[model samples]
Target: MDEAKRVEEGLAGDGQTQLIKEDCQGDLHKKLDRNDGGDRVEDAPEQPMAETAEEQLQVVKQKSKRVATLDAFRGLTIVVMILVDDAGGAYARIDHSPWNGCTLADFVMPFFLFIVGVAIALALKKIPRIKDAIKKIVIRTLKLLFWGILLQGGYSHAPVDLSYGVDMKHIRWCGILQRIALVYFIVALIETLTAKRRPILLEPGHLSIFTAYRWQWMGGFIAFVIYMVTTYALYVPDWSFVAHDQDVPRRYAVKCGMRGHLGPACNAVSYIDRQVWGINHLYSMPVWQRLKACTLSSPNAGPFREDAPTWCLAPFEPEGLLSTISAILSGTIGIHYGHVLIHFKGHSERLKQWVSMGLCLLIIAIILHFTDAIPINKQLYSFSYVCFTAGAAGIVFSAFYIVIDVWGLRMPFLFLEWIGMNAMLVFVMAAQGIFAAFINGWYYKDPQNNLVYWIQKHIFINVWHSERLGTLLYVIFAEIVFWGVVSGVLHKLGIYWKL
Candidate 1:
């Protein structure tokens, strides 16, 4: 019986049977078929390791289509920026802040900075080699720095007063570009140096190597600490630009050779700025003077010195060296949150929900708080101002993400995306008198016969209750129309200008 079974098994060991066994267990088949007879059959080809990796990469690419939320958020921010900036004035509009607090207009800059930070986090993931990454960062940093200086040049052109005999030098060293350069360089360096650091506890666990650099909370902490300490130390009442009492102000005025009151020369910040930058070219007027004016205001209705105290000397200029720290902190915080959304996929939904609720509550709290103690002021970049503006920015970005990314909705207004793509070009055009020149042509004319003015009087004023609303709508319509033409050209030519 055993011999009959063995003969039957041997008969079953044909090429078809062996092929079936090999398909089930290739390793076992290889060992069984190592004989002369078995060697007659052909061996299957093995797949290369590189081919497997390529397939895995293709899978990742397909999965990454959902990250377009960042771009949509950026586009929304840019649109708001353009609208607020081009508005003739905030009067009778939902825009503009109340005294000493923020408005819809205040949220734009923080949103821009946050978008930049998000880009930084995404870029860190695509670097093929560390050396290449460092090189790219250096190149971008230099470009931003150069562009910042060029923008500063815009403010440096002395403001000529043909009517008045005053020949004041216009010092334009500190501005938007300068701030961008400072923030970009510092944030980029932080990202590069800490490239190999471990992920934070709050970060998402399912991220790929390309998405692991979202841990920017450390940068945020550093920026906040530096800004608070530096501003407090340099601008506090007793230690720096602020006055301790009336006696101190009087003593400083006496020392500066001014009569009873302190003039610009007697003001510590102005004097120092004039000394450092020279009287012929002091770019510190608006900011430093504004700060001085605020510090000297009387608690009750009474006379106060026009000039800042001697302590103000330390942080005398508008684009004062120290204030940049706070601006940078604001940017870092924005970037940190942006990176969190991009890298960690696990907590994003929860984060979105929390951010939405938090921002709504924060806006309410800020409005209440602004009623007393401090007013929301963008010029000062006050703590409450930062909180209020950032909260608004958060809400805006979150909404964009929900609609465009989560819900997979299309951007019907492609023009906004176009403007966003060429944001630098748009900004430069606005700053360099191009848009002003065009708008002035449309809006201004001799009283005898102006086209837009005539249209406004006959049509808009006749139809609308408030002419202001009509005028605003006209301005907004013109802006959108102009942007449509510019964006169309940009899209056709594939022109994108980034810093």
Candidate 2:
């Protein structure tokens, strides 16, 4: 999440700044030195060893060369992730689309991939040795995969469910962290492979940046082609799956002899997942169950409709193989933004590049979506979906840059900055329900009488007397704000959990 920064130092004719720097260095140096990665520098000398004013100014400049806006943007994404996951059940529009449209929750995964792309540009800007870069990428990839499988693989049932562990035959293979690992591996390797190639600096408006990062863009395009070809050209035959009703397994057949069908019944995305991961291993309770066609209770999960289609009972993974190919394009779009941050030093130039690219993407998305050529669907990870989300991501990121980096509005967003700095930790504890599980494990008397349940019931629900409003408020105050404060404390202690 690193980006280039400019530091403005105020030097007084009375030599007052130097005196302040000398006094502040003792405490500031310790705090700054403990910061992870690009956020920190070499420990400052206890005494001002610099004999000249120029040397002292260099020290100040070096200490302030990391981007604060990037952290704020990442933190904002984390907050949204918490909000959608915790409160989506109460508000259907905020939840992921049941089949073929975007919603608040659908944006989380792409936003993460977009941020990862920006991070890759900053992280591997200069890879001195290919072997070292490969080693680091592999290690981080393995770690993400491990955590993904552990957290989302049915290993720890939290909150409502006190039980933990899942049968190996039914463990889910793909999820948020797992998809991120795959995307990161591919995108990082591409950047590393092309790190040595120098870009020609043509005029800014003349597709110059595209020419510079053309190889990465080309790679993304190739992946998109593979996804499109498979989705349309590959035939999906009749398939049967076992549906357990009242603990009684019954095999039902679904008719799908089509080559190109984007419906819930048959699509290359779900087909590929079922063929590879097996039906038992896929996500049993997919978002499609919330569709009006399938659910007796529209926009929510409940009893199935009397004539609900057989496919409604089948399992599907949203982060399946074919869809992930389209997701790679999302990461590449992010890389383009990161490259803008790196090559362009001037604020206006950087913003101009970001806004222009963002608008172009949005325009393309609108055409595709309106024409029905590629409907915006998160389940399928449609081309229009990628364009729309990535385009929106670029615009949102630029706004944050303007607000936090340019306008110096840091005080208002300090909470987000803290969460952004320790994003992984918060993702595990809050979003994954690890912290909730732990507190629930220590409940008094009945398992339902946990601290989390009590607070949500007494403090939020009872006071408000509205299920939807109370649930939303609980997530906002108890989950998002509480985690923000925890992350802030961790940030103050100079603690960060990196990948």
Best by lDDT: 2
Checking candidate 2 for backbone clashes, the offending pairs are none
For model 1, give the RMSD to the true fold. Answer: 17.4
Which candidate leads in TM-score? Answer: 2
Query: 374-414 in candidate 2: lDDT tens per residue?
Result: 99999999999999999999999889888877787889999
TM-score of each: 0.62, 0.88
Per-residue lDDT tens digits of candidate 1, residues 176-217?
Answer: 556566666677567767766735433434333224544455
The predictions' CA RMSDs to the true structure, in order, are 17.4, 7.6
lDDT of 1: 0.46
Off by over 4 Å in 2: 1-63, 200-205
lDDT at position 335, candidate 1: 57
- The 10-residue segment of model 1 with minimum total lDDT is 5-14
